[model samples]
Target chain A: GESVGLHLPTLSVQEGDNSIINCAYSNSASDYFIWYKQESGKGPQFIIDIRSNMDKRQGQRVTVLLNKTVKHLSLQIAATQPGDSAVYFCAETGGGATNKLIFGTGTLLAVQP
Target chain B: GAGVSQSPRYKVAKRGQDVALRCDPISGHVSLFWYQQALGQGPEFLTYFQNEAQLDKSGLPSDRFFAERPEGSVSTLKIQRTQQEDSAVYLCASSLAGAWRTEAFFGQGTRLTVV
Candidate 1:
């Protein structure tokens, strides 16, 4: 079965440091990927997204990198802060008409001051 | 209104009971989606609708689970004979368009507890 999974279950980072969260997906047909941040008692907030045509995309203080060859994706956060602490999820869509997202187990990001 | 909204932020249902979760998408949004999130796990796709038409329902766990978006706006997810395993947060999301590249906005979700 096709699955999207994280390389690390949790990632602890010092404040002001950079944080990297990684994900591995099995579906080659998946063309759209998104990174979402979910805080306690809240819905998953969209952080950034990338299409298959592009290998990387950047947003405010965050970046998403995609490696089609390795079926790997990563989210990079610069200057990690306490507010950035949350469970991060990587989701993919087959780019079909339905465009239903398949999510992976999340990675808890803890920022230490 | 501003974003996707779910009703009854918290729900407690007895085993074998039925529960209905509601979702109100943003105005004029063309796509609606339902997902189930278990404790400490990411949200899993449940069903999807394009406008008033149900486009995909393969992710529905079983026949006991059903969803509807009759007007292509407000949607509902109903669980029949709820089980303990059915306890989770039900999230609803909507996108401006049904395109594959569109971003989906999510609601805070309705937390369902089956006891």
Candidate 2:
């Protein structure tokens, strides 16, 4: 399960298990959202994204679910592997004044063997 | 270039010193962005440039921070009167389109430490 808050959260799971990461955005008008995975000493790599028009989108081994009523987003990894270990971030864009992604604190996903 | 590239992977500056971080985005990227990531935090938007025009700089934290992209291919982020609070990893990203329309590629980032 995933918890939503301002502080960074940690999700530890077995290599073959499933992992879920969560984020709560502040703006209600946000129209787009993205999930990024960042390895240590490296830049963020895009994993998946969901627009306001859709409540759920599926990618290879990953799924993003958006709950507009709660203004919440979640990323689920299927059969998580050690290679998936990294800090996962959820970013949002209201397409308003800034037109920039407003990123959440991030969640550290650790897959233990 | 094959991907986004940043210079001087690591930097340490005195509290009052000024520093410049550079970003070489992917070829033909129309949108370039600068972000600041503090320890254990996700990247925060600083500024954005569409080609040579700086369309958005509203994310810059203060007057001490400035960014420029004169020719549209490369960009620079400058910080003046750096303080301890200024220490963070500066990340640069670029996309094929403007705003939130596309996925952005990111550079490794420059770790700036103000001592």
DockQ of each: 0.52, 0.57
- Per-residue CA lDDT of model 2 for B1-115, tens digit only, reads 5999999799999999999999999999989999999988889999999999999898899999999999999999999999999999999999998854678889999999999
Q: Return model 2's CA RMSD, one decimal.
A: 2.1
User: TM-score, each model?
Assistant: 0.95, 0.94
**Per-residue lDDT for B17-74 in model 1, tens only?**
9999999999999999999998988899999999999989998999999999988889
lDDT of 1 by residue, A1-113 (tens): 12233543878889999999999976899899999999989999999999999999999999999999999999999999999999999999965656689898888898889
Tell me, by DockQ, which candidate is best: 2
- Where is model 2 chain B poorest over a 10-residue stretch in terms of lDDT? B97-106
What TM-score describes the B chain of model 2?
0.97
Off by over 4 Å in 2: A1-7, A97-99
Proportion of the native interface contacts kept in model 2: 0.65
Model 2 CA lDDT for position A76 = 96
- In candidate 1 the C-alpha lDDT for residue B60 amounts to 95
